[model samples]
Target: MLCGVHNHDLAPNLSGHLLAGRLRGEEKQRVIDMTKSLAKHRNILTDLKEKNKESVTLI
Candidate 1:
C-alpha cells in the first residue's frame, strides 16, 4: 500500500519527463502546475511529520 502511494505520487513526474517533448503548451503547463502543487503539499507533510517527531521526543 505504501509502495503504491509512492508510485502514484511519482507518476506525474515520470509522465512529465516521459512526455516532455511530446507535450504541447497547455499540457506541459498543467504538468508543471501539478508538480508544483504536489511539492508544496509534500513540504507541508514533511513539516508536520518533523513537528510530530519533536513533540514525541519531548513527551
Candidate 2:
C-alpha cells in the first residue's frame, strides 16, 4: 500500500526527468518548497520543546 502510494507519487518526478532533460522549474521549486516546509515544521517542534522545557517531565 505504502509502496503503491510512493510509486504513484514518484511517477511524475520520473516522467519529468525521463521525458524532459533535467529537473528544473517546478520540479526544483517543489523540492525547495518541500524542504523549507519540513524545516519549518522542525523549527516549530524545537520551539515547542523550548516553550515546555520547564513544564514537561518524563515519567
Candidate 3:
C-alpha cells in the first residue's frame, strides 16, 4: 500500500499499523517528514497548474 501526504486520510490507520510494527522512532519521524514534503510539493504543483490555466485563459 502507498502511504504519503496525498493520502492523509489514511494516516491514522497507517499510524496504527506502524505502531504495531517494529519501526523505530527516528524512522517514523523520517516517514512523517517525507509525507509532509510530498504534500507541500503536490500543493506547489497544483498552484502552478492553476496559475498556468489562468494565464492561458487570459491569452
The C-alpha lDDT values of all candidates are 0.45, 0.46, 0.44
Off by over 4 Å in 1: 1-21, 39-59
Relative to the true structure, candidate 3 reaches a TM of 0.29
Per-residue accuracy of model 2 over 1-59 as CA lDDT, tens digit each = 57546544444333324444344365446546756777565554445445444323121
Residue 54 shift from truth in candidate 2, angstroms: 51
Please report, as a residue range, the 10-residue window in candidate 1 with the lowest summed lDDT. 50-59
lDDT of 1 by residue, 1-59 (tens): 57546544444333225443254465446546756777564554454446444221110
Considering every candidate listed, which one attains the maximal lDDT? 2
lDDT of 1 at 1: 56
Ranking by TM-score: 1, 3, 2
Using all chains and alpha carbons, the TM-scores for the candidates as numbered come to 0.30, 0.28, 0.29
Clashes of 3: 0
- Give the residue spans of candidate 2 off by over 4 A: 1-21, 39-59
lDDT of 3 by residue, 3-40 (tens): 63464354543323544444346544644675677756
Displacement of residue 32 (Cα, Å) in model 1 is: 0.5
lDDT ranking, high to low: 2, 1, 3
Alpha-carbon deviation at 40 in model 1, angstroms = 12
